[model samples]
Target: MDFTDHVVVGVDGSSTSIAAAVWARDIARAGHWPLGIVYTQGMAPDVREMLGEGGTLMCVESTLAPALVQASRTAAMVVMASRGQGSTVLPIVDAAAEAVLQEAAGPVVVLPYTTWNTLDRPLVLGLDAERPSPASIRFAVSVAGRTGARLKVIVDDKGQGPDRARLQTVQVLTRVLGSDLPETFDVEVSAHELTDALLAKASEASLTVVGSQHARRSTERERSENRLLLRLSTSPVAVVANTVEAGQADGSATR
Candidate 1:
């Protein structure tokens, strides 16, 4: 199915979910696309009023993961709160969010309960120089272009020289973006761990994007890293799946 029509957000009547819905609404509005709110049960009247029009509300009998996965099949992207409904005192990624991130056909955005103070910050991207995903790079550039936001690409050196890491990043970006690169973007090679570097960058960013390989299932280490990133990121984190397989050429942007 073509995935370029609507922005779908999963809500559970919680304030966190409502915040995510509002974020999704703004994205839909900006892109001139329709918005979809998927919930399992009844939603509050005030919440519905806040969301307003140019969207559809869908109630699914199943759990949040299945509902979001079904909606993501045709959506440009799927969004959800980092923690929802029965969250505990300790901050952790909700089960449903984790499941959807792993199984969703398209990108999955996880919004934290804490709201960002401003929208002028750059769009941060955590890129792996050794195994860069063209889909992720294209998605970040597309969002940066549409929002008129600067793009900050972060790469971990992993003991390599900063110059070499930056060079690798530039090569991958040039190949992926070609002439369609964002007007303002810079590559930052960090010596710290990937998760730590992203956390620091996300604190001052409007949004942070990372890539997840589209596979049968994620390894334990990958799952742990994803959970850590989602649990601590100060801004909304977008986990874009690398739809293009290894040894295959990159295709057009899905969004």
Candidate 2:
């Protein structure tokens, strides 16, 4: 089926996958977008059993690789559960979720199964302290603008260049969004570790925003930071890739 501009969710019958599907459903409903539930070909029977009913089955060779590629090609945004039910930690970005953040061409939202009131907290955007990506900021701004939600921009200066990083971040947002940046949006520069700082802020946030990694080309530190943020955040984390323009958003083909 054609899934253009739709919200696509990857499901393996795990609790996390179900949570992702539910979250995607709410988002699609809120945005008046279509929703597609995707299931890989060789997942376990229990995973299949969770289907219970009919939905578009995006049969693929691998769960994260092929499925995400297809989702990126046809979907506007892909939703994934950070970790499944078997995870030892309460929340962690599984290997599949990591691959999605690294490779997805569009926006990806990684969520945990934990419960929280999305309406009460503000939307938090975690800026890259080294080189902030304009796409990431713009995407977050778009969401906050649409939802009329308060936005918090978090920059972990730590030992990195806080002044330079903060300047670049504000410039990009102001350049890309101009006066469109929400009046409720605020920027915060911190000296704490990137992951640690974001976790603390996200604990009370409704949703956290982050940029995508450069897939195979990303450094170990880049990949680890994104993974840690996804795994540890108490709020839903949105990972926006630099593939499509922030305005012309949505996902997958293959590589």
Best by lDDT: 1
lDDT of each: 0.74, 0.67
Model 2 spans with C-alpha error above 4 angstroms: 40-65, 85-91, 113-120, 157-169, 213-222, 248-255
Error of 1 at 73 (Å): 1.6
TM-score, per-candidate, Cα-based = 0.87, 0.76
Give the CA lDDT, 0 to 100, for residue 186 in model 1.
87
Error of 2 at 223 (Å): 1.9
The whole-model C-alpha lDDT of candidate 1 against the native structure comes to: 0.74
Candidate 2, 164: how far from true, in Å? 9.2
Candidate 2 per-residue C-alpha lDDT over 1-255 given as tens digits, one digit per residue, 9 for 90 to 100? 566777788876677778777677666655555667776555535444554343345655555545775576657678888875355564366667767666676777888767464635787888874566666777777666655568888887666577876776677677767866666567788888767878988767777877754433444323677777766678888777655566434221110
lDDT string, candidate 1, 69-92, tens digits: 877766767889988888774656
In candidate 1, position 198 carries an lDDT of 94
